[model samples]
Each structure stands twice: as structure tokens, then as C-alpha cells.
Target: MKGDVIFGKKGKLSPMFIGPFEILEKIGTLAYRVALPPMLAGVRNVFHISMMRKYTSNLSNVLNYEPLQLTPNMSYEERPTEILGRQEKKLRNKVIQIVKVKWLNHLEEEATWKTDKDMRTRYSALFDKY
Candidate 1:
């Protein structure tokens, strides 16, 4: 549809969808031109149908989305929000400590396991509470 919203990109540790941009016009049988915000001026406005997914609006599914301050390269850094849990992986020689990390702009179920040592060295403040 012309006014439908769609998923932009599947970025790592970022929101699955970006905007509810209006469809400007249909380019061909398989492509459509999108009305993109000024912040995404550098991005290509036309997209194929296969790359888009219709966004369904639900009051309960609404989220408070904070726009990221992207660098010149159209990228932003992802930071850890908290340490959820910890576990140890035993290898043949040594044991590796891993921590479940919840990152900003992500849900609890999306949390990932990362090396405790590397996370501590990079983001030591997250470990202060524990």
C-alpha cells in the first residue's frame, strides 16, 4: 500500500525496523519509491518489494524509539545496558567466563552471551553492580 510502513534493515543489536515512511510511487512491478526522512537522505529511496515487510500497528506493541545520532558513515555505536546473567564454558584446556548482556534499544529476549573478560575491559561500569 502507499501509506504502509516497512522494515528498513536487520542491523546487529539495533531495532529491526526503522520507519513508517509513505510510499511515494510505484517504480515497477517489483519496486517502489519511498519517502525517506532528511536524516536518511544519503540512502537510496527506491526499494524492491522483497526487501520490505508491512508494519502492523498495535497499541500494546508501541515503543519509545529514540533516534540515534549517526556518524558521517550512517552508523552508530551500540552500548550494553546491563549484565543479565553469567556462566562458564569449559573447554579441553581452560574454562571461559561468559556473561549475558542486554544492549540498548533491545528487548530482554534479544540479550546475547559475550566474553566476560572482553566486556569488562571495554565496559567495566556494567560490572559495578555485580
Candidate 2:
């Protein structure tokens, strides 16, 4: 398949992007055209799809993607600490306390182990042996 990609001539293989790049270019021009707003073509979805494809990759769903070190306690900086200390809080808060104690343990989830393990795993500079 890759040989088809590499060795094939410019027009030999199917267009890899299937002309979204052309549409994206048009959207850019339309964004600048305040004189005509509806020329945008109900294209918010198109813009969202383009941005998502640009910023994120299939790697985001893979387990092999490098883990990020997030300070679970200080991680939710937007939330107040009082939320953690609230006694009347439900079991979730108790769970948060346990997570704070274990640092990255906050990511722990049952049934779905991959996300939790990926979050807690200490990633190294070295590549995976696999």
C-alpha cells in the first residue's frame, strides 16, 4: 500500500485528501468575506471536521501514544479545593481524595483499563520495543 503511495506518480494514485484541501481554502476566503456571511455554506461542520483532522491524529486513540504527566491534585486548577474537602459531597469526592493521595491514581477507571494505564504509565524517552 505504501509502495502505491511512494512510487506512484503525482496524479497516478487517488487524491489522498479527496479535495478537502480545496474546500478548506475556499472556507478561509469566505471567513474573510464579511460582505457575504451565508457564502459559508452552513459549513460549521466542515470547519470542525477540518480543524479536528488538522490538530488530532489516529495516534490519539492508540495505547502506544506517549503518556502525559499531569499533576492530578493541582491538575484541576480551575476547580476550588473546597470541592475536594466538602463533607456532604458524594462518593465521587472521596474517590477524588484517594486519587489525590495516589497522585495519578485519579485517572484510574474500572472495566476500561487502557486509558487509566496509559495515563499512569511513566513514559520514557526510548521508543517501544514492539
Candidate 3:
């Protein structure tokens, strides 16, 4: 289907599917030619059918899709938005501090636990309020 929406990988974020891009044409029996945006000029327009998933539109499943600014290498920087919680893990010899990190464009539930030292070094602002 030419006008049907399909899932395309964008970056290292949860709900990794980036677009419901227009399907230009079928490449062969198992491939498709997608119409990617100008920002994704460096990306190949063709994709195998296995790599794509049909996007079923739903009113309750709204996604806030923002266009990502990719560098020449097709990579983008992901930033931390907030520190959700903190905990200390006790080892045999010592205790290590870890923080729950909420990243930009990700939901709170998707936040990950990272070492406090690492989070402080990369996202010091998250600790400013505490």
C-alpha cells in the first residue's frame, strides 16, 4: 500500500520506530522503497520487509514524533532530562550509588538505572536540585 504507514528505526530510544513514512514502491518480493525525508538523505531508501512494521493508527496511542537532527554520520546525541530516583547497592566490600535517569524523548517508565558517578559526569544538572 502506497499510503500506508510503516515503522522505521531512528535512534537509540525506546519505541524505536521513527516514522510512518510513505511507501514509494515495492523493490521486489521482499523489499520496499520508502520515501524518506531530506534529513535522512544519507540513509538508504530501500529496506527489507522484515525490518519494517506496519503502523496501525490509534487515537489512544499518540506518539509525539519530533524530527531528529542527525549528524553526517547518521548519529544524534541523546540527553538526560531528569533523575527520577536514587539507590545504593551494597557489594561485599562497599556500596555503590545508582540513579534512575529519564532521557529526553523517553517516558518515565523507560528511565534506566545508571551509576551515580557516570550520571553526574555526563548530566550534572540532574543533581543540581538535590
Candidate 4:
């Protein structure tokens, strides 16, 4: 479940599905026991039907959906690619700068707005012109 992509934090850029795993057995009427890879050992094999999707017969789909190469800790890095836009939020006594950041390997729509100060501290090259 943790390895499979979801719609929120990572946005639409995340993969929709991760497998065509073998269904070991049916669980009552709503769930199935799937044989997941060793990488997903920590997760429960039983999943709700809503979480599964019918696979379209496309060789490309299998080739394109590269399973995430995860660390032993089961986490991956998300690095920012570039700054797309910027804005300032004016408070009572200070101005807060924010920038829309495009992430590496992700589309423009997946970009998120973050505080400029934090971005600058982490990725100073993104603000070279300013």
C-alpha cells in the first residue's frame, strides 16, 4: 500500500498502479490476497477490490511502469527541478515570499508553492537571477 502511488502529496505524476501481481486467493466477496514482491513485505497482502484495476493488454505499460527503486528504509527522494513562478504574501509587518517549484521528472501541473526562504536555503541555484 505504501509503495503504490496515491493521488495526494505526490500529485497526478505518481503512478496509478504498481502491479499485475498474482492473486493468491479471494477473500470473501470484496478483497483478494495478492502475492506482492519482497519489497512490499511489510504491507498486508490483502487488498480491497476498489484498490485494484483491470489491466489493459499493453507491453509498453509494463515497460513504462518502472517499479520505484526504494531504499532499505522504504523512502525515496523528491528533488526540486526549477522555480516556475513567485509571489509575495504581505503580513502586518513582513512580506513572505513564495515560489512555485517544478519537481524533477514531474510535470508542470505537479509543481507546488513553497516558501522562498526555505527554497533558497535548500536550492539557491533556483534563484540565481534574483
Q: Residue-wise lDDT of candidate 4 within 20-128, one digit each (tens)?
A: 8899999999999999888778778999999999877876665433466688999877889888899998999999999999987577899999999899998888788
| Cα shift from native, residue 13, model 1 (Å) | 20
Each model's C-alpha lDDT?
0.86, 0.31, 0.83, 0.83
Q: What would the per-residue lDDT of candidate 2 be over residues 34-124, giving only the tens digit for each residue?
A: 1213333443434434333342446555554345455765353222111111112237445321112122323323212112223235332
Encode model 1's per-residue lDDT on 1-130: one tens digit a residue. Answer: 3433323433354455567889999997999999998878877999999878898888987778878878899988899999999999999999999999999878899999999999999999988988
The collision pairs in model 4 are none
TM-score of each: 0.55, 0.14, 0.54, 0.52
As for lDDT, the candidate ahead, 1 or 3, is 1
Evaluated at residue 89, the lDDT of candidate 4 is 89
**Tell me, what's the RMSD of every candidate?**
8.0, 18.0, 8.3, 7.5
Global CA lDDT computed for model 4: 0.83
- Top candidate, metric lDDT: 1
lDDT of 3 by residue, 5-108 (tens): 33343334435466889999997799999999897787789999998998999898876787888899998888898888889999999999998888887788
TM-score of 4: 0.52
Candidate that would win on TM-score: 1
